[model samples]
Target chain A: MIDVQNITKRYGHHTAIDQVTFSVAKGEVLAFLGPNGAGKTTTMRILTCFMPATEGSARVAGFDCTEQPLEVKRQIGYLPETPPVYQELTVTEYLTFVGRLRGITGPKLSSALDQSIGRLELGSVRHRLIGNLSRGYRQRVGLAQALLHDPPVLILDEPTVGLDPKQIIEIRELIRSLAGSHSVILSTHILPEATAVCQRVVIINKGHIVAEDTPEQLSARLRQSEKVSITLKTCPPDCEMKLRAIPGILNVLPGQAGGSFLIECELGRDLRDEIARVAVLSQWGLLELRTVSMTLEDVFLRLTRHEDHLSEPAEATVSASAERTDA
Target chain B: MTPVQAVIAKELRGYFVSPIVYVVGAVFLLIFGLLSYLYVGFAGAQAIQLMQMQGGMAQINLNDLVFRNLFASMRIVLVIILPILTMRLFAEERKLRTFEFLMTSPIRITDIVVGKFVSVFLIYLGLVALTTLVPTVLMLFSDFDWNPIWTGYLGMVLLGALFLSVGVFASALTENQIVAAFVSFGMLLTIWLIAGLGNLFGDTTAGRIISYFSYMEHYDRLLRGLIDTSDLVYFGSGLALMLFLTHRVVESTRWK
Candidate 1:
């Protein structure tokens, strides 16, 4: 439903987004993962036709964003980072204005307003001025405004930034429910949000697409080295050397507690059994042994860090492995 | 409803909801009342003096003596107050970050500009209409040629429209409302001062051009009951130019 092709946005000499490209199929939820100033909002603005890209082109619902901006705008429901709301307008008034701007009128407009108010749970504050509402209510009103038109494509920039934890969960659930009917492109810096609510994750850094894959696939690809935590009743003097001597084991480090050790090994290698056998032979009581998997946060950090080290030619092999893991 | 109509309605609603409208309206009415009271007092005193000299009721032209001067003062009052009415039209949108919503919507840039201009013009019209009460009360107490009074009002409306357009253009140039008001005031004052420069040139081609650019010259003719098409064209084209410039500024903002 959306295709962004090699789009670059520059403010004078400063390039906000450079040669960025991505697409979202119908009903697919794509998370634009990036830190602050990673051009996420810039890309969203381009796709929503808020501003034209300095180079390349973007198409939404088969209409070019710059050439046929009205059509593209008609297809998109955008929630900007600051929630584009009038402080003096009540919730109903704001929604009605937005609906009219979208060419909705009469019974259709009122029904759409009611539906969105119900969906975003804004019915309670529908009569109150937006300036008087709390932050959470204001964010919901912003979401409701976006959904008022029922466009096939939704471009939300940082949709869950200011909500409390419970509100965050409710918003995530709301976004999840939008899948399979609306193609959603939501930008967020929060890693867990992407993993929990998105079907595909695109990690962006410094205006470049650093990595793109399913959340689980990204985690697995970055975890080329396995870690195993082992706790013992008593540590033998030679325990470290013994664990290091095992085949395929790369390194050993002390764990957080006393008499606990973390073992590292290459991928596809299981060092738990070997460590347990060695501990039994050395008369060191084994209390715990388990392999650790990489979290999405770890994967995001690895990808961004790898992007930062592009000048180092030797690390090409690690990136090559990441590409190989994509298969 | 069309986008332009929707924007106008919303903007009018916004104006009514805020206390700015009431305060500005009350202040304008108070200024009009004071000016009218003083004009009436002076006209009354002149009539008594003429009666004492001629030993009969003196024939005083209220429209010439009072309404003309009243409108001249009103022109200056509008110059000061109209900017306050228009400063928030675009500057507040920028400050509040609602410009994003406006530009991203399916509406055209012309709709946004025209809609904002019309809303403020209507508020100014309402203010001008309220001042009509002064003339209406004056009509009850004296007989004067109604042509000049009607013409004076027409001049005020045209001048108000032109000033409001400039105010909108100024607001579009900045995100600060106070700065918008000052810039608008400066622009209007410079145009008003152009008539002063016309005197220095004194009948030269350059003098005629400068005088033609003076809004006061066109407004003065209309106030004197000379309904020339040239003056109408001047105010009409001036309003169109300012609104067009405002539209360009708003459109360029998207590119930036």
Candidate 2:
């Protein structure tokens, strides 16, 4: 379990993380989504107790980060953006060192080391020096180090950043397998990765939480209007006129829908009710009727744009519009 | 073993597994050997010539010769060997970005600092051991006493430890290994040369402060087989001050 309460980090005059707050329950996977410089890594650093917040606090597994950093560190398995690996040491040696630093020892340490190696599929190159390993293998070793101590909370910052598609899939599967046993807060700007692995997503833009919900809920927010496509036996000459006369008809746009008229209107207006009324009154045969739904990608773009607009000052809008050019 | 011991063991293992440790050791031994051999030959010949000219038995005081050689040899060791021992201590960790992994662990800051210093110190100690041959040969062939040899080495260890501490502290000040090495060498040189300036100035209050602050002044007195309590206190306090500063620098950098 992790609770980050209004944690703010400031470096000189620049605010890196501004009053950011979120919570992840045990066994829950929370995806932190943001573009570059969105305070995602800053937030994860606070949650893992790697860096103290300038204001407010966070608790990992019931231990306050500022007050009991060692205890918080004990419960966290953090993989920083660059993996924080020692290039000179062998894979096994590096993991063993991390294990010992976390107070793992004797047979338990051996067991944890073997388990992490197997989980991350690092058995083949366990003894190879980390400097000699490929980038993907190095990333796996970094993940293996985080998993060595078997901490209850895992804070990974862009785990799949530069991995190939296959490595990304492997890492995604690895994170998915860790879901129910370890509470994870994975941060990445990659939408598909977050959608594929995280149960809940927190979208941040410019040091603020723009949106937080399940993938389904976030997609729902983008569905302000639903467009229903319909195929009739004939394209009626007065189709737009007839549809506009119906109640709850926000707008009626008629177009060739597979050789029939297409109807687009407000969501939940059930233009289906009004379209049925108009069609029956006019005696036009209906062939196909389907409502178009918004995808997660669409929701992401809309929310990020909306957040950008909301954060912009009114004076900048005019100058931005005047200087803007279309290519 | 205890946790601190476990950290120390792992640190030592790291030192041995990497080429940096062995390279530093080899270079230290090479320099120590060449400098001590040259100092012994030159000083032994000169002492024998002076004793012959004074109508003595041409059997120079080998103890005096060893004391002079130890002091001369240590001057070069502190400049070159001390930097190699400490350049990579904290800077390499930062360059590799492994400092975060190490600092964020459950181990206390003191443990990491102490463990790293102890490993470097052990390597220095091993290098010091190799130089024992010069004094051993003198005792075997000539009438050199072992007291000055032991005391000189004791002074060398203290001076080396003090220099290492300063290097360790300087290493913690930056993430660039070259910068740490050069800065440490400069700091050691300033302290090494300040006593000569003190004698040149002669008895001024500033001169007294400079003399009291000089690392070589205290070390030179100890190399004469006389362990003054004030000199002992100065070396011990200097070592403590540097180690404490190193710890503070390391702790502050943990967050950054």
Candidate 3:
């Protein structure tokens, strides 16, 4: 479990994180989403007790990070962006060293080492020098190092950054499997990574937490209107007018394909049935009708774009959803 | 294993697995051998000259003529070599970004500093031990007092340990190994040159204080087989001070 309360990290006149706050319940996976320079790594560093927050407090596994750093460190498995590996040492040697540093020894250390190696599938490269391994293998070794002590919490900063697509999926599945046993807080700029592996998403932009919620909730909350795509067997000049005349329909625009249209309706409105009935009555010969939901990527861009406009007072009230449907 | 022990073990393994230990070790032995050979040759020539003039056996203290000078040369060699040995201790960690891993671990800053200091100290000790073969070979050919020889070795170990702490401190000041080496070299050179400043100032109060700070003054006393408590205190406190400063530097880095 982790609790961070209004932690602010400042460097002279620059604030890396401004009153940013979030927490992860035990056995929960929280994705930290932010663009580059969003202070995601800074926040994770403070939570891991790697650096002290200029103001505020953080606790991991109920141990205060600053007051009880060693205790907090004992319960955390951190994989920094650089992997924190010794290029000269072999994979097993590096993991063994990390295991010992965490106070795991003898039979327990051996078992933990084997478990990490097996879990990360590092058996083939176990005896190879880390410097000789590929980037994907090196990343896996970094993950293996974190899992060596079997700590209850994992704070990984972009764990899948350099991996290939298959490696990314494998790591995603690995992190997903860790949800019920280890509370994970992984930071990444990749929107789909959060949707795939994390239960909750915290979107931070420019040192501020812009949004936090479940992925679905964030998508739904940011979606101000519904969109429906309808395809007709034949095109009519009045098709757009007919769709716009329907109740709750805001706008109807031609789709990229011929005889198809994209309809925008007011929030919480279902125009599919009405459009289908109207098409049948008017002899429009409807071929397909489907509702389109906003993806997590759309929600992320909307939230970040909204934050970007906070500096311009007059345009600040222009809702992200309004701009989306109008565009 | 304890955290400190684990760090020390890992550091030592790092030293051995790389070419640094072997390369430095070979160069150290070569320098010691050449210095010992020259000293033994000069001492032997002096003894032969004395015998020829007196028409009898000349009393020559080989330990005085050879071992003392050998250690003095060793002190200078250590000043040059110990920095090379210790430059990577902390600087390499910073360069490779492993300092994050080390600092974030559950270990204390003192443990990291002390572990690094001790590992390098042990390697220097091993190098010093290898030079003992010079004395062992001298024992085979001549008889000499062991007291000064042993004290001279004690002085070398203490002085080398002191130099290592300085090297570690210098290494902590920067991520560049070359800069660390040069900074430590400059620092030790300043300390060594303080003895000359003492000579220039004579017996003035300022000169006395400066000379007291000179590591050579304390080391000279030990080389003569006089192990004063004050000398031990000087080396002990100086070593501690350097290590403590290194710890402070390392701890301060986390805040920055």
Candidate 4:
């Protein structure tokens, strides 16, 4: 459990995070979705008590981070962006150090170490020096260090940044399996990671929380219009104007192919029936037809970047919707 | 392990793994050994010449002839080499970003600072203790009072503790090890040089007070086996001051 209330962090005149407020319930995995330098790491640092916020407060496990850092730290297992590991230490040695630092010892320490190493699948390289290991393995060692203490809260900053595709999938599956047992707050720029593993997403940009919702709800909330994409085999010179003249059709734009057209309509309106009837009466050869919904990527781009991002060429929307099924 | 003991163990393990400790230790021992050998040879020649000139086995006090000078010469060696040992203590952690790991943990800042200081001090102690082997062997072949030799070692220990405190303070100021080493070197050199300037005043109260701030007088007294409480107070207060300043720097680092 964590609660951050209007915490602002400023380094002189430059504010890293401004009045950011968010909370995580027990066993809920929250995604901190943001691009680079978007105050995600800053918020996490304030929560972890590495640094105090310039104003306001953050509490972890009912203890104030600034005033009761030791207690808050006792509840948290943090994996910083760079994976704070000693290069000369072996994986098992490093984990043992962390475990002892956490006050776990004897059989308990070994069990915690074994459980974390097994979870991260680091048993093969346990005896190898961390500096000699590959970056992915080092990252996994970082993960193992954080998990070894088995704290109530886990704050991971870009946990899957350097892993391979299979490793990424494995890490995502591991995070997904942590639900209902760990309160995980993972920050990542990769939108699919949030979609795959998180129960709630908090999108931060320029030191502000731009949007916060479930993955599906985030996309649905940002949708200003619905779209219908159709491809006609026959030539249609006046088809664009006719579709624009329709009652609920917002606008008609070019689709992928030559005879293809994209029709934009008001939100929550499924104009497929009207489009189909018009295609039958006009006999404009309906080769293929489908409705396009905005994807999480489009929602992210719209909220973080220029709001008019989605209203660009219809091809952008088409590709965005095409990416939806990929996730 | 307790928080402080765990950090000390980790730090000691770190020193042994790095090449800095071995290189610095070898150089320190080599200097001690070479100086001890040269003093012994020089003492032997003096005794032989004295016998040839006037007498039957003229007196050559090894403490005055060898151990005193040996201990004096080691001040320079410790000032130069000790910084190399301590430069990486806090600076390397800052550069590697492991500082965040330590700070975010449940350990107190004082525990970490004291742990690192004691760990390096133990390594230095081991190196200094190794030099005692030379005197230990010399004692078997000759007769000399052991009091001054032990006091000289006590002087070296106090002087080194002061040097290491300054080193820990300097290392806390920056993330660059070379810069840390040099800053400490400059500070120690400047403090030692203060005594030279104080002598310009020649027994004036200001000169006496200024010279008292430097370590040379107290260390000299200890080297001669005087063991005054003032000298002990001087080393104790100096070490405490440096450690307190180091604690402040470490505590303020999280804010920065």
Q: Write the per-residue lDDT of candidate 3 for residues A40-86, one digit (tens) a residue.
A: 99998998888899999999999999999999988999999998989
Tell me the DockQ of each model, to 2 decimals.
Answer: 0.84, 0.47, 0.74, 0.78
Per-residue CA lDDT of model 3 for B72-153, tens digit only, reads: 8887898898899999999999999889888788888898999999899989899889888888888898999999999999
On a 0 to 1 TM-score scale, where does candidate 3 land against the true structure?
0.93
Ranking by DockQ: 1, 4, 3, 2
Cα lDDT for residue A101, candidate 1 = 91
RMSD list, candidates in order: 3.7, 5.3, 3.1, 2.5
In CAPRI terms, model 1 is classed as high
What interface RMSD do all candidates show, one decimal each?
A: 0.8, 2.2, 1.0, 0.8
Q: Per-residue lDDT for B152 in model 3?
A: 95
Question: Candidate 4 docking category?
Answer: medium
lDDT of 3: 0.88
TM-score of chain B of 4: 0.98
lDDT of 2 by residue, A46-103 (tens): 7777679999879888899989988988888988888787777788888888887877
Which of the two, 1 or 3, has more DockQ? 1
Clashing pairs in 3: none
Predicted candidate 4 versus true structure: per-residue lDDT over B1-256, tens digit per residue: 8888888888888999889889999999998999999999999999999999987978889999999999988888888988888899899999999998998888888888999999999998999899899999998999999999999999999999999999999999999999999999999898898899889887999999989998988988888988999999999999889888999998897686
